[model samples]
Target chain A: MKFKIASGILSDGLKKVEKVVNWKHNIPILQGVYMECTPDEITLIGSDSDESLRYHIPVDGENVDVVTPGKILLPKQAVELIKKLKGEIVLEREEHILVIKYGKKSQFSFVTSNVEEYPKLPEINFDGPSLILKGTEFSNVIRKTAFAAAENDIRPILMGLNIIANSNELIAVATNSHRLGRVILKKGTDKEKQVVIPAKVLEKHLKIFDLEKDVNVYFGSKNQVVFKNGSLVLYVRMLEGNYPSTERLIPTEFLTEITLNRLELLETLDRIGGLSDDGKTGVVKLQIRSGVAELSTNHSQIGKGIEILELQEISGDNEFSVSFASKYMMDALKSIDDDYICFKYTGNLRPFLVTPSSGSPEIEETQLILPVRERDV
Target chain B: MKFKIASGILSDGLKKVEKVVNWKHNIPILQGVYMECTPDEITLIGSDSDESLRYHIPVDGENVDVVTPGKILLPKQAVELIKKLKGEIVLEREEHILVIKYGKKSQFSFVTSNVEEYPKLPEINFDGPSLILKGTEFSNVIRKTAFAAAENDIRPILMGLNIIANSNELIAVATNSHRLGRVILKKGTDKEKQVVIPAKVLEKHLKIFDLEKDVNVYFGSKNQVVFKNGSLVLYVRMLEGNYPSTERLIPTEFLTEITLNRLELLETLDRIGGLSDDGKTGVVKLQIRSGVAELSTNHSQIGKGIEILELQEISGDNEFSVSFASKYMMDALKSIDDDYICFKYTGNLRPFLVTPSSGSPEIEETQLILPVRERDV
Candidate 1:
């Protein structure tokens, strides 16, 4: 667009939307940042068909000045070039070409794509059943479960995270069938809504949002949702199929309950996990006894590792043992940021739950892992 | 094998030799580190057939105590486990199973490979024509040229760096036909020898060596070269081939010479190089005029970038132009550690030279780039 903006401002706006740009779009024009320049503001939009991010840059910024108002689509290269250059970045359209100039030392020109060829970004609705949560709370719930989401699933619905907002709590759950992570947080809202979004969509926006600020989320119709905070807006398309009942999947009863320092357990799991069999099958045994829990992995090809971690408390059964994929356990253990974490399970094959404690109402978070079943081996 | 060694010391020793362990070895035993523990010292050796590194961990080091003498071959897992654990690590063999214990909290058992299965390290002779140089000097020369070594080569000999010890200089040269780097350091040795060593071997050893200390280089027989200093020893196989005479390839007479700040030119090259047609075809033109050198990359698909840099001096034709792979020029320019570098060329089609100057003769370094022929494009 024919506009002069601060390099930093443009770089930040471009970065937010760049992640949503469909690099593999059938029409190459869709793989560009669509910019609309008006007398008061400039809007940058990027979309990957399923999701989009639209960021607005006001003209009142300290170093930005609008020379003219126009619309154009700039490729990733133009954004990258501006990010590296210093001082004011001036963009002027010459026919179909966009000329980018910085200081007096350098100038870059890109053949601008036809803005009309780009797909329209998903519509954003400001009024809807919404949820309001601190960015950190929202991010934490997503972070705990996103990793458990199926990466490339045969059942595509499993690739999305099931998000439910009801009453004062917002719960997000993700699973790849083998393991599940459910994070429940207080959103301070009474609105109720349920939607499943691609884990990747949440992951991308998580990278940019300032976790300390409040993020407003709105459900747009049944197929779309929008997350907005300050000048940044994210649009995500809801999955069509049904997500499995995650609550029933996480077992309700336990024969044993053990509490240990989260960091201590994480470190121990990491060491034992180091000797995983060929990286693919990282099954390790957790022998919980009085005072200590022994984490061990015995692989015939690689080696064997036994890590003894001191337990904070133990109850229910005096001694118990279970086997699980070490990587899955480590992921669950690492996600918990608490002084002590508790583990509850009923049988060796049942999915165990890992949480901060059995009685913490301030914040609710739980991770469930299905043990590496002996039958599967 | 049978010793109580500090975790830090053992980890450091394992790290140095780990690079030599062949990750892609067909026989898993060959990838193991052969360790021999004596009453006084523990020797750790790793070999990938062509190259090897042997590091000695003395028992007298802090937190180390030898209870007995033994030998065992430890796999990557065992070493990695010990590297992560803290406190004193005790390695004691229980028959064929080697128990690696750290403090009383953790223990990892690796089924030791038969000592006879691991390949022996190359023989290192002390009484040979040798040269000594500060590790920094040795590393600097390698750093400047290693990147030019053919990564995947039809001419396998080009994958190695031709090192010549003649009269009073130790010169190292590497080229992949497209570009060349020659580093000539005044080693002040009279011994004459020439060997082409696989650049990858030097690169691995360079990663572990302390650049500030002195490194000993020994030319063993006609097929092997050994590098050793303090507790570290590296063995590299020497290639046998007729290396092209590098001295003749560098032109003494030139039609144009331009001098500019090395950093300034490098930065400008980087910016102009960013706009390459595609990552694969990075041709850029250097237009050297009276007072300024204009670096530009004009690609029909990716667009064009022009960077104007001030020139300190220019001679011959008032303006001359030449094109080369922008990445090659940037790599060569970045390697020169000089405030100002001089460029000398004869014609657009001829190879050009980039060096600090004609006067700084203490350690002469030159980089050459062959212009991309217009006919080839």
Candidate 2:
């Protein structure tokens, strides 16, 4: 391909697609980014077998000039090189190599891989039911629930974020059996649908919607979903298998409720969490008496750490104790965006709910953590 | 032990000494910090057996109040807890448990280790040869030469930084056999001595001399060196081995000399260095012809990158090409505190010198990198 484009434009385009490129893939062609140049625009595609990213840059006479229309495959190293260059960049194909010129005296050349060997992007038909929402709102929903998804593939369905959309609301839920995070947005589409999107795909492509713009989500072919914003498009493969029914997992009633400063509780948990000797699941006990609550953890080889937190507000049962994995509690607290957080407890071993005291009118966020049995601790 | 101290002061003290504490050590007591509370002051000591750090906080009856004078060994977890607390902290020993009270409603108890089992600091006789210099100056010397020291223990002597002091000058040198860095300060004492301090010790304790105060360096007892600044003292055990003679490694004469902007050269190397496939030792070729230079690197499976840099000044032989490890060149260039850097080459394969164009009058810095042989590539 022979084209002249601004270095900044090419750099930004490469960065958006490079996130999906598996640079360490055994197949060399899989690590290459396919570039197609036309009279009107240029398209760059990057994929890692399951997911793909496509970025389009319009060719304007001022910043971008197209001398000829062709195709070439640029390896990860070449893309990295172009990102570091300045001024305008001119790329041309010569026999089996692609020559790139930048700045006043810099020239780089890469042996292009056969463009035919690059896998074609999965066909996405946008005729299906679609939903258009504020990019920020969708990102916020993902941030609230994606972290609770299972990171391993042992339970493939649990590794995907389940999103159920109806005419009035959209609910996103992610659970790894122990903990669950759910966020509901008071906006949806005309048709009702539910799809489980890989949490990894949602997180890695979150930056694409960083700008204050609107994103269109489309349910494409079976097992395929498309997210489009401006000239950038991302195609993610949906996880197969039925997601567990988690709607009833959240309890609506509680015997005790307490509100405390979010930051204070996080600090207290962080301080005492290290005292527990359990490898990854350090257990800390929370005991509430009168208007004060104490958090403590003890290890046979280490020591004991205790911190007392003054409750801002308390109701229902006044005295109770619960033991939980400190990391889960901390994660639930950090996801809160409010100064004060409220906790509702049912029993000692049941799942507890955490939410912001002053909830967002547009989005409702709820975090649930299953407490460790006293005997287990 | 009973004492009430401001959390900030105690936190800062723990941070300084905690760097040497091997928290993952097999012996539990070895991972503890020894605290001695006397009527006049409090001393906090942390050691990993080879090096020890002692910090003294005087009892001025304001920030510190000692009710009962005693000693205790606080485990790593306890130290971490205290670092995260705010306000004044009152630590009182009650039988086997040490109760720590902070804020209004926070109280923590830790099972303190037996103070009698903690290892004692090595005794040093302060009557040995000593050199007093600015703390900043000593820290600067360590930064310049420490990175060149061998990180592996295969050659114990190469893992230490050699310091030779005399009435006229103090010289510091470190080398991993392939590259050497030598810095000389035009300040010293009457007694002349040479010692090899472990690079790990010097690097770990560099933060203690960050202030602009005067630092007293004492070559204490055999195989021991002490660095004291104000109330903070660091005891380092010298490596037991004969340091190799590296004075002759630096070339005195050169066939070619080139001066270029330091930042420009660094950027160029960084851009093209990744094109090579030699793992960590990516080699880039630099060719100087007439008054211009070209840097290029090529990998059979990857690509080729070339950058042309206009020379600011050139002397001696021109039209020569030399290849060197990009990482070594970048490290040496970063250590020079100058805008323009000068490169002196003795031959294509011999070790070359790198220095600042406007050399400092008080401190002379020299960096040498051995070029990669063509056959090796």
Candidate 3:
């Protein structure tokens, strides 16, 4: 494309899209960023087969000039080098070569492959139904629930987070068998539908959102989902499968529930976890007696660690012992925002839930961790 | 060891000695730091078979108390964790266990190995004489000359920098066959012999300099050298064989000698070198004419890049074209400290030299580079 653009502005746009650029050999063109210069704006697109990002910088109201509306695939390295340059850059396309000139230095034209050689991404029809939510709120829902998705592909369905939007409620749930994270949002209408989005793809797509304005989401059938706001468009393919039934995983009763300062409990668990025999099977034991909870981990080789944390109230089970994977407990505890955290458990083997102490009964933002199987000591 | 010291002080001392700490799986005790506690000072020693570091921290004036004088081996991980902690940490040794307590929250005890199990470094008797130089000045000399030493151990002798010290001058020379960097310290006075010090050991040892005081160097036969200052003793084993003759490599007569601003020429070479093909021989071409110098690099695939630098004056034989590895040029250029850089050459294939454009020829530090074999364009 023939154009003269501000280096800083173009660099900012290219960097945002570069995060999505795939360097895999499956599709060589995908390794390069797509630069399309129109009379009004210059769009930069980078993507792999699963997710794609499109960032545009408007030249109509800025100090930019588009001599010709054209398209080209810029090599990843060249694009990065040009972005790091200063001042204004003049881009001129002469037949198969693209020459860039800035200041008294001019880098000779580089050979460019024919635009027809690049794979054409389907023009997503934005005519599909769309929903708008605050960028920050949408990002929070994705991050909080997405982490619970299964990293192993043994069961492909477990790798996707279930997103269900009903008439008056929108719920998101993710589980990796041992742990699950859920977040809920209130909706205005009563209509409903369910979809499973690959957590890996969704996480990569959300990186382009600056969390400024409202982000719009649209999807149709098993085709793809589109998120756009301002001059950026992120498209992700929807996973084709039904999510596992997590409704039964939630506990409806609790024998022991107590509220303790979030930081204190997290720090105590962290210290006790140091003595875990094997890092992965980090089973931290929690013994609650009176108003103090002694969190500890005992290892024959590295000695044991015991940390006492004061609790406000731990009634039902006066003195109970339960063990959990250290990582699961730490992740759940970190997500609690309230000054005090409440841990509810039905039994030692059953799933235990952690939520903000100030959380309302109707609130859906709660972290759940399934206790590990333990032999009595 | 029985003592109570501020966690920050202990951590800082440990970090300084961490570079030489054993990370291999050979001697189990090598993975642990030796802790010796005295009423006045706490000495921490860490070592690999090849390198050893002993750091002492005075506790008499600090928030420290010594209840007993003892020596014990504490695992590196335990020491690192204690360092991460705050407040005064008490160290108590009972049998083979080391109990570390800080506040009421931290009570960790690690199994310690017997201090006697660790390998003891041989004491080098210092009956010979020694020379001292300011720490900063010595460090600068090492930095300027060390990079030219051979990185690979193919020629063990070349891996060390040959140091020749006479009554009036201390000459440091390092070469990797491709290029040689010679720095002359005419300011120093010594009635001494020549000694070759391993570049790698010297590099690590130089960091221990106090920056305020002068460092002493003592050399002896049997391929051994010792550096001592106050309580710190650093010993390095010298190379077995003779070093290459660098004096014969430098050309005595030059057909051309041109002077230019050091920084300006270096920057121009850097920019032009970007276009030079890597791996096959990174050769950047420099063509100097009357009052003008052209820097260029021709890459078979990436086209050519050329930049013209205006020269104040150029006095040499009619015409000459030569090319050297860009990396060697950059390394030599970086070490020169001069407003004007003087380039001297006898012929295209012969070794050319670069020196500061100034006074006494004997005091000048020279950088020599062997020209790359010329190929047909």
Question: How many residue pairs clash in each candidate at the backbone level?
Answer: 0, 0, 3
lDDT per residue, candidate 3, A219-251, as tens digits? Answer: 545567777877788877777777877888888
Chain A TM-score values, per prediction: 0.93, 0.95, 0.92
The model with the greater DockQ, 1 or 2, is 1
Model 3 iRMS (Å) reads: 3.5
| lDDT per residue as tens, model 1, B1-377 | 47887788888999888987876598777778888888888899888778888898877846778888888888777877777877777899887888988767677888776887776665667655379878888888888898888888688899999999977889999999888999888885666789999987787578799777778888887588888877898888887677777788888899988888888877776667777544434677888765688888887876888888888888877688899887888888878777888999889899999887553566788899999864221
For model 3, residues B1-377, the per-residue Cα lDDT tens digits are 68888888888778766667764548888977888888888878777756677777877755877889998987754665665677888889988888887767657776767788877655555544456767766776787788888999999888888988888778899888988888877655454777777887887767776767766776655455766655555656677688877787888888988877888777666655655434223577777765567666666565455666666446777467788887788888888776788889788898888877873554557888888876443
The global C-alpha lDDT for each of the candidates, from Candidate 1 onward, is 0.81, 0.86, 0.74
Candidate order by decreasing lDDT:
2, 1, 3
Interface RMSD of 2: 2.4
lDDT of 1 by residue, A1-377 (tens): 47787788888888888887866587688778998888899999988777888899888845777778888888877877777776787899887788998767678888877887877765656655387767877788788898888988698888999998887778889999988888777665565788999997798679788777778898776588888877888888998888888787877788888888888777777777778645434778888776688888877776677878887778898687889887888888777777788899788778889887644565677888888754221
For model 1, the stretches where C-alpha displacement exceeds 4 angstroms are A127-129, A188-191, A279-281, A358-360, A374-377, B127-129, B279-281, B374-377
Name the TM-score of chain A in model 3. Answer: 0.92
Model 3, residue pairs in steric clash: A167-A189, A167-A190, A167-A191
Instruction: State fnat for each of the candidate structures.
Output: 0.83, 0.71, 0.23
